[model samples]
Target: MNTFSRRRFLQAAGAAGALALGAAACGGDSGSGSGTGGASALTWWDHQLQLQPAKKRIFEKFAKAPGGMPVDYTFNNPEKLGQALQLAKQSNQLPDVHSNAGLQVPAPQLINEGWMAPLELSSEAVANLKDVLLDGIHIFDGKVYSFPIFDYHVYTNVTWFNTKVAEQAGLDPSAPPTTYDTFRAAARAVQSKGGGAAPWTWNIGMTERTADQLNYLAQAAGFEGNTGMLFKNGEFAYHDDAYVDSLDFLLSLKKDKLMMAGSESWVDTDARGRWSAGAACYYFDGPWCPGVVLSAAPQFAESLGVAPILTPSGGAVRTYHGPQSGDYWLTPKSKHAEAANKLLSDYFTTPDYSVEVANTMSQPPRDLDAVEKSTAHAEYKKLIGWFRDTVFLAPTPVVKNVAITKVQVETKPVEPNLGTIIQGAFTGDVPDVKAALKKLSDDSSAERERAIKAAQAKGAEVSLDDYAFPDWKPGADYTLDQYK
Candidate 1:
C-alpha cells in the first residue's frame, strides 16, 4: 500500500464513524448546566476521546472547574482533526478548544489566516508555565498561540535493538555502538549470524520516514544536527556534501543488504511489526517504542535495548527532540476564549493534571519536574532521564520577513521527500551521488527563489539575507535568542 494512503486509512478508520454521525452524536452538545455561574456549554475536541476511562475522568474534572462549563468533548484521531476542523469551519461551529493535531498546518499560517486565536496567559499562568514547560516552545511572533500538553521526551531518531539478536550475533548488547564505524561492524556481525535476521529495518516506503532516516544519518555525519529539514545559513542545504555523504552511507547499507529484504516496500506498521518479531536487529523510532513493543510482544520486553543513533567518530551525538506532537490551541471564533484558556491553563500547568497526562500517554508532560516526580510508570521515568541526558533541541528559524516565513512555513520552498531519488540510488537507477545531490540542490534553490517572488508580489519584505544565519553552527543549540 502507498504509505500516504495507509496513514490516511488508519486515521480515517478512527474518525469515519464519528464523522458519519455528524457533530450531534459525537458529543456535539453536552447540554446546558450552571454549577459555577457561567454559560455551561463549551465544546472541546481531542484525539484521545477514544479512551473511555480517560475521557470520563477528563470530563469529570472539567465539570468541576471554577466556571463549571459543560464540555461537549469529541474524539478524533490527530490525522483526522484537521479535516474535522475544516468541516467545522464550513459549518461555523469550530470547537472552542482543540489540539493542533500535531500542527499539521504551521501555527503561523493558522494565526495569520485568523483560524487560531492568540493566547493570553495570566501572570499566575505565565509563572506556572515557565516553571514547567521548556522555554521558547509556544511563543510565535512575540505571542503565545499554543500550549504544550504532552511531549515525546526521547528524540525521534533513537535506534532500538533486540538484545537477544545482539547476543546471538556475538555482539555486546550492553555496550551498543556509539560510532558509525563500530555500528557498521555490529551490523556485519548481526548479518553473519545468518538466522534470517537483518541489521536494520524502517518504513522506507514512506517519504517522511525515509527522509527522517536520511536526516538521522546526516546528524551522525556531523553536518546538520536534529532539525530534519536542511537549513544552513538561513536557506535549504539539502544538496550539500554532508547530505550526499549521508545518502552514500545509506546506499552502502542498501548495497550490502544490511536492511531487511522488502523493507523498501514496508509501511510504518510493517517495519514496526518486523522489528517486534525480531526479523531485524535494529529499528529507529521515538520513545514510545518500549510501551508499544512490550504490549505487542510482552515476553520480549527484557530483550529490548534502546539507544541514541550512533554518531561518526568525533561527531556530536545530537538528534531532533522536543514537542513534535499535538498541542492545545484556542480557536479564533471561540466565544468562551477566557473560559477555554482557563480550563487549558489549569489542565496543562497544574501538576496533578500534567502528571496524569504523562502517565496515561506514556510520554513526558510539559512539566519536566512532574515527569521526575511522576508515579506513572518506571519505564517512562527511565525514558525521560535518557531523553534529558541525550537530546538537544533543534530550533526552527523564525524569519522576520513575512515572505521568508511564507516560504519556510506555508509554501515550503523545499520538499524533504527524496525517497524516490534515494530508492533509485539504492536500486542503481541513479548511481552518481554528487550528480543527484547537485540536482536536488539546484531544484530546491529554484523553488525557493520562486517562493520569494511570490511573497514579494504579496508585499512581503524578503531577501536572501533574511534566510541567512551565518553564525549558526551545526550540533549547537538554535534557539529564539539566536533569531534575535
Candidate 2:
C-alpha cells in the first residue's frame, strides 16, 4: 500500500499529515508532565487509528507489562501528526516514541539530522526482531533504530468494486477482467448501464495519487519496480513505454468520459464516500480501502469486492514494494529512550501485539501468520490474501549503497515532477505526454548526478551506479543478498 502507504507519501503529504496534534501538545514534550500527564510517563505519537484498540489495551496495561511505563498516547491522522512533529522538532520538543509518517525524507537523513536516536536495545530484543529487519531501512550505520511493523508486499492499485454495480454492468463481481482492454471495456459497460453513475472513480484531485496510480499501472503494463527509476539500471525512466502508456490509459479514461464527475476535485475520502454509496462502479485503491470503506461507507461493506489491479492483456502482474521500514521512531532528545525502547522492543513486537496489528487490517502485519488468529473482517482478510499472493519486495538503492543517503540529502526536487506532469496532462497544460516524461526523466537524472557529485565532494562515497540492480527478477523478493 506504499503508493498509499509510507514510501509513496513523498509528496502531497508535504504538510497535510499534521492536523490536530500539530497544534495540540507539541509532541508530549518527551512525556514531561507539562505536555502528557505526569513525569516519567512515555508519550507516544502515531496516526494509526485502526490500531487504536490494540495500542490502548497495551497502554492501559503497560505500567504493569514488561518494559512498561505510564504511556501518554496521542493519535491523529497522518497529516496532523506530521505537522505536530515538525512543529515540535522546530520548537525542540518531540515525543519519546512516534511513527515515521509525515517526514518524507530517507530514514538515514532523519537520523543524521538528529530527528532519531539509535535505539539502544538489548541483544535479545535485536534477535527477536531480526527476521523482519533490513539494513538501511530499520538499521543504519551499525545501530538499530526500528524494525518493520507491517508487511512489505503492498501497492496502491487494488481494484475494488461495488457488487451491485458489477451486476448492473453484466460483469462478474467475483472474477473481474484482469486485462487492460477488457478492464476498460468493463468500465465502459459500467458507465453505460451500471446505475448511470461514473464507471470508475479515484481522487484524481490528489495529485500525488495520479503519480502513484501511474506507478502501479506501469506494472500492469508489465514493467518492473517503481516508476521513478528503472531498477535494472541507475537511470530515471519517466518517459519509458511503461510509464507513458500507463499515463495514456489514464488519460483515455478521462477522454472517454468514464471517470466520475467531480473526480477532478475529489479527495481520496470523498471519492471513497461516493463510491461506497453506489455512485461509482469501481474505485481503484489499496489494501487498506476496505477498512476505510467500512468506516466511511459501512453499507458498502457487504457489497464490496476487491481484486488485484488489472494488467494489459492480463500480463502476469508484479506490483513491487520498496524495502521494509519501521513505523515508530524515537527522537534522540527524549529523556526516556530506555522506556521507549522497552515499549518497542519488549512489548510491541510480541506475538500478542502482532495479533492485534493483524486484527486492525488497515495496516497488515509483517508476518501474515499473525492473521491466523486475527479477528479481522472477511473483506479485510481477503485483501491480505491478494497482498501475499501478488505483491513483490523490490531492491533499493539505499540497500545497495548506504552512502546513497548523502545523495538523497543533497538532491533537491525538480519542478513539474511526475505529479505535476500528470496534472498538466489531464488539465491540457501539457499536450505531449511522451515529451514531458522524457524531460522529467532527463531532468531528474541530471539532478541525481549533481547530487552524487555534491555528496562525493562531502566525502560520501556514492554514485549513480548505486541505483542499479542487475540481478533483480520480476516475480521474486529482491532480498539483501541480491543487492550486490
Candidate 3:
C-alpha cells in the first residue's frame, strides 16, 4: 500500500492541531496583570531545530537584563508546543514570547485569530536586515510580524556525484551533468558499471523531497511559477499545463527505471545510508546531509562534492537564494511587549550572542556584523555566501485556508477519490493522462471555488485559475508552443 497519502496527511493533521493549541496557549487577549509592575518573567516557546543556540542566548547570555528580572523558558517542538499550549491556555501557563518557523503549520491559524503581537523591528534592526541576509519571514500585510532566526537556509539541495564512479564510467567528475539529459546520461554511465549500487539516490518519501524533485525537473524544463501555489493574476490555477507536465515528467522517471530500486520506500535515513555505502553515483539532497555523512561514513566527507541542480534552460531556480531554516520569534499580545522587544533585539542583533547562536546551530547569522565578527565563519560560509549573492527572498504565500493546503498535502481519495488523484497519475494507477489531468483540473477548480467562497465569508475577495501543464521540446525550459 502507498504510504504517500498517510504520511503527508498525518503531518498536516498534526500541524493543524498544533497551531490550534499554539493559539489557545497564548490566549487572544493580554491578561489582567502588567509584567512591568514587578520582576517580569518571560516564557519563550520555540521549536527544537535551533535549540542549543536559543538556550545559549537566553540562559547564558540574556537571562538577566542589565538589572531586570530573568527569563523563564520552556522548550518544546512545534508539534508538542501546539498540544501543550492548548492545555496551558486553559491553565494560564502561556508564554510571553514564542519562537517558531514563520509560515509553518501553526503560524497561519495564529495570524488569522490575532493571537500574535505585531512586531515592529526598530530602524536599527530593519537596517541590519538589508539584502545581505534573507528577509520576508516575519511579514503579513506587508508589515513585519516576527524576527527571523537566520537569513540563510541550511536545507538547500545540492547535486552530489561520486568521483570514482564517474571516472570509471569515463565521464569527467568535475564537469558533471548540467541538464536532465546530461544528468540521466551520467546516471546511465555509472549504472552500466554493474559493480556498485544504483547510480542515483534521492529523497522519495518526504513531501519536500517530492516537491524538490518536481521543482528541479519543472524549473529545468522552464516552468516559471510556484507549484504549490497555483496562483497568478489574483487567482489560483491548479489546471496549469506546466503543472501537469511536471507530474508527467516525474512519472516518466519512475517508468523509465532511472531512479533507485525501491526508491518509493526510501526515507532520508535509508537514502543517506545508500549514498554513504558508495551505492549511488549521485545524491540530490540538502546540505544538512553533511552531518549524516559524518555519522554514516566519515571518509565520505573528503570525497563529497557539491553543486546546484542543473537546469536544462541554463537558468537557476534560486533555491539557495531563499530564507534559511529555523523559526521567527513572535510576541503573543504580551503585557511585556517592550521588554520582549528589548530581549529580542539583544538576542538577535548583539554580536557576541548572535555569533554564539549561529555557531551553535551551524546557522548563517542574520546580522552582517555578527557574521563578519565570527572566527568560526567557514562553517556557514557556503550557506551564507550563496544566499547573499544569488537568492531572492520573497514573501511567503498567503494561504487563505491552511487547512485546505494541509489536506491537499496529506491525503487523497482512492481511485475516483479527489485527494489521491495526483499520486494516481504519477504511479500509473490511472491509465489515461488526459482524463486524469482533466479530473485533476476539475477537482482543483472545485477546491478554488470553495476557497473563494470561504474567503468571501471572511470579508475578503479571491479569484482562482486552474493550474496547467504544457508540452515542451526535450531540454527546452518553456516555450510558447508548450501551452495551449
**lDDT string, candidate 1, 1-484, tens digits:** 0111223322322221000111110111112222112245777765443223444676678778677566776666333555777877788777787665523455556667666776765555665545223212344444555655544344445677888999899988878876667777888999999366899887665444456567666766666533334545655566666678777766677778888888776655677778878899988765555554554466876777866666666444655443332266688888888877777666555667666655453445656667666544454466577667555555443323323455444355343336567666666777776776666667766776787788777766666666555666655555534555
- Per-model clash counts, in order, read 1, 12, 28
Scored by lDDT, model 3 comes in at 0.47
By the lDDT metric, which is better: model 2 or model 3?
2
RMSD of 3: 11.4
Single out the weakest 10-residue window by summed lDDT for candidate 1: 17-26
Provide the TM-score for each candidate, comma-separated: 0.72, 0.86, 0.61
Q: Which prediction has the highest TM-score against the true structure?
A: 2
For 93-174, candidate 3 gives per-residue lDDT tens digits of 5577665422224344456545566554445555444322211234333344554444433333456666666787787866
The root-mean-square deviation over C-alpha atoms between each candidate and the true structure, in angstroms, is 10.2, 7.3, 11.4
TM-score of 2: 0.86
